[model samples]
Target: METNNTKMFTEMFSEFENDAEEGQKQKIEEINEILDEMDEAEFYSIFTKEMFEKIDQMIEKKKLTLENAILLLKHIGYHNVIVKFFKFDFHVSSLRFRIENMITEEEKKKEGKNEKPLVDLCECNLLLSNGFISEPIISVCVTYVLKVAMSKEEGEEARKDVEMALLALSNTMYYFIEQKLYLKEIKDIVQYHQEHRNLTRLAYQSVWQFLFCRLLCDRRLEDVILNKLQFEREAIRELEELTKCIDWKKNEDKLKEMEEENLLERWIIALNIYFKEFQIRKKEHVVLIECIVQIYQASRSNYIEICNLCICLLKVILIRKNAEIEDLLKGGAVEAVLEEIQRPTLDDEMVYHILMFFVNASRRLKEEERKEMKRKVFEKLEEEGYEDTIASLFETFDFLNRKYYDELSLDISNYFVNI
Candidate 1:
């Protein structure tokens, strides 16, 4: 039985060693069938050092796709292989670099050819998604991409390289963040691109793509943002500059080039997710929190859809227990909510979101912070000459808190009664 198995493995490897594309598909199919029939333990037992050396030779000779190599490893239950590498303290960086190089070659060949350029990219993504790729492999790819992106004189080829790398990193960021590998590098890359005014649009947007992936996968990215960017004050200034840099004409040109709408809104959604996921209440986030409040204030006058989004976002943010609300109060968040709640044509649902902000803030914040927030809320309402409105809204808040039903009607009624 051992002789037969060894002979079969040797035959399979021999078939793949052929230089001709002719009969390759059939050979691959045959190989797949043979692998499928083999038990996992039996397959794993065949991964001798000689087999890896042969595979490495095939890879070096451009005789194998990284995807197929990965699939083979996966089929053989690659965990033990990784464990062995770890045990021996093998340097896997060269192997990872080879895979990265293979993917880049494939991408370049894809331009005019029908063959898929990013097959390796997709394969790496799949491996990472399945939690199979080793940490060392991930680090190689991420570090390479960051190096390309942060270079002072990146040309067109470098730009393409960085974009592909960023997209791959974006997809795999969850795993990297979870393992806490190379986080400072990612932070530095994002901060440099975000702070630099003259980077390519792709370079700037790549950071947001990275952020979006991290937000989807891990909330702790908020800690990275806070510590790395000091986001509260920086977010405000960044946003102000970002908004000011928008030229309608240039925006239209960008839309034409990218064939996508709502590019600016992507940033908004990412920020909203970060704010929603981690409820840290530090003063650092207050500038951003207040900016959201101001955005709500400005949009309410003309853009109801944006106004609704802002209110809903604020509702999510108010759930954080951190002392961040003090800045919101100082920034006039209460007044913004009050004004929006009493808007003539506002939807009851929007009002409900605004009220829920208060309810959540009351629940999530420390007692003293919540009380101070409440006091400031009322004081701001009075300052805005909405004392009577505050009384009606408070009653509505109580009714909703007590009955916990008729929330929609209560919100609507409160708005009208306040008016």
Candidate 2:
């Protein structure tokens, strides 16, 4: 018993087979219209693995051209209203079969075996950007794109392929993270770009997106990513460069440019993730602490977002027992906190985290070290006129009835006063 949806699909497939080239535009419109009219269950029933296999078979038999097939898929992909209602299984095996065939055909053409390539670069790009969303589909697309992007083939066409592959990968990267797939391959691609430095502007952005996703998804890969790539050193160097170049008070344009680059943001996020599970080493501890203090010393008016991020990272570092409080004091952590607290327009959340950094630093310390830390913190506070800052914050919290801020403020006050 053929349902109306299946019958409609059959009619459309026949039209695609019979007039693969001549009436593709009309057929595509008709197909989209049919899809738009169907309900979710009907749409799924008509567009299943078997249907994809049939399309694949048609391409194999020369009844449907690869270009037309890609066009059809693109239109279907753009059917956002219909697509949002159901999880459209992308029929990965069939798509893989078509892609493999296309690759094989290209190889044959390279060997002077075929007159016309079955699939050209434009069609390949179109197929890849078809908005396929399933895990298996994304995995296949990513694997294919990485292979092509890393291939030795040279020319404008090859470069276009690499660019297109990167665009496709960027679109699917979050899905890759959610599925937790292809960690090593993504790492290799990033490392490849790092060594080569050949990616275009857009491609470079996409690669960084991949790297950031890899950093956030897997904790076990942190050592390999950070050490092999020297990411922390690179991040510190970039931060130092920005601090030298831009006057935070008068360089809004420069800051916007840096924000667009996003290299620092990626590094900060990766470092935050890395420090969550692992203790900071002596070397990283020293450099990162110095880096934070430098940023604080330079920028009080602008870069508050980056400032807040650094403070949060410091909070994480301070929570771990292995981070020596004495090193923090020596590295000017106290001064950095005071600088941030003294900002004219401090938010409640930022204040809470700053106070909590002090709380965490003082936790589990030896009595002698605790008193020493208290002495250093209080001296810095008094030197910077922090009493007025605390008084103002207390009044704000009391007016707003922010209990969390009240509690955290009291904890830091008690910790320092008891010493």
Candidate 3:
């Protein structure tokens, strides 16, 4: 007796082999209806690797239209939510063949053959964009595509393959992290692209976004990414070496120059992840605080999002109380916050966080330290006309009726009172 899956596969294959497009569409729809009614185990039984090989054979023989093939993959991809231990080797291999053939067609087109490839590149991209495909399948496909992309020599053909690979990687990155598949090759490729400046602007942005998503989910990658960005060991070494021979004023200039040399885009990506996904570890507090303060100072005017994230992360650090206030103060956190408030378009959320940072930092300081902090802040405020800045911010917070407006306002006012 044939199982339900075996029976459906028989019918689907029969319909696929038919010459009439309407018959094929009808058969596909009937099979889709059957698949829609089946549960995970049933779907798994019908969509196995052997089944995909059969479909690939049909695809090769020109028996199934690209639309039919894509529809079948779409169903499998959509039902990916329930199936476990999915056998995707055949499908991935088929996809690799399609992509390579598409590139070959692209090269041929340049040489005067206007023939399009049998597979639809856009449909393939859309299929991967479902965001439901399993990591193993995506990993295999991405590995193959990136290998092709990197190995190709400089030419239009290489650029097209690279663009296709980047788009596919971007679409599948969400699943990559969701399924906890951290491919080291992907990390290496993203890092290489960052330095090479070879990809188009859109592709460049896509790969960086892919790295950002991966970093957000994998806590184990934190140190690796930070070290690459020089926010860990290298940053500490540089700071130590700079302090050996320089006064604070000259040190500030040297640090600013060093920070300028680093990529602002990378800093923004790492900081966004640090702010949203994970807390900075205690050991990272000193270096990260210095890094955040410097970047905030460098970007306060031009990059509002980075500045906002910097302030929010600083607030987290202060509330956790893992780092000493002296470290924050000496790292120029106070000056960064002051300069941030001077921005003309400060939102209520930003204002609330900025005030909260001050409130949290001054909470448990010693009396002498409090006095010194107040004197230092007041001098800066007086010199920069930040007295009016604070007052205006207070009025905005008061109008917004933010939950901690009263507490934050009083704490900041008391903390900065002139002696």
Candidate number achieving the greatest lDDT relative to the actual structure: 2
For model 3, state the Cα shift of residue 285 in Å: 6.2
Q: Give the per-residue lDDT of model 2 (tens digit) for 1-419.
A: 46776678678777766674768657877776666556557766766767677767877897777667766765554342212334554526476456655555554454565312333322243233334444444454455556655654557777666655554455443343533445566556657766775654445445544555555555665666567766666556656765675556655564344433244444455567556756556566777778877775655556666677777777777776435777777778766875677677888778777767766766756789777767766776686576776676766544334655345443336644564
Provide the clash count, candidate 3. Answer: 0
* Candidate 3 lDDT by residue in tens digits, 1-419: 45776677676676678657667777777776665556555655666656766777887888887666766665554334212224434345555456445544554464564222322343253333335444444554554455644543567777755765554555453443443333566556556665675664435544555566666555666665556643344334433343333232224463343322222433344445544554455565667678777666655655565568778767776776656777777677777886776677888888777777676667757779878878777777777586686677657655545555464443336645732
Cand. 3 TM to true fold: 0.49
lDDT of each: 0.53, 0.59, 0.57
- Candidate 3 lDDT score relative to the true structure: 0.57
lDDT of 3 at 262: 27
> What tens-digit string does per-residue lDDT give for candidate 1 at 1-419?
46555467667778886734545445555665555444435554565545666666776777876556655543332223211122211124244345556555554563563233344334343233323455645554454445544555556775655554454454443554543555666676667666665354444554655665666666656666667665555456655655455442334453232212133344455567667666566655666667777666655654455567667666666665443556666766666776676675655466457766666555555767756666655565565466655554555554455554544334433332222
Give the Å shift of residue 376 in candidate 2: 3.4
Q: What are the candidates' C-alpha RMSDs?
A: 15.2, 11.6, 15.9
Q: Arrange candidates by lDDT, highest first: which order?
A: 2, 3, 1
In every candidate, how many clashes are there?
Answer: 2, 0, 0
Candidate number with greatest TM-score: 2
* Candidate 3: clashing pairs of residues: none
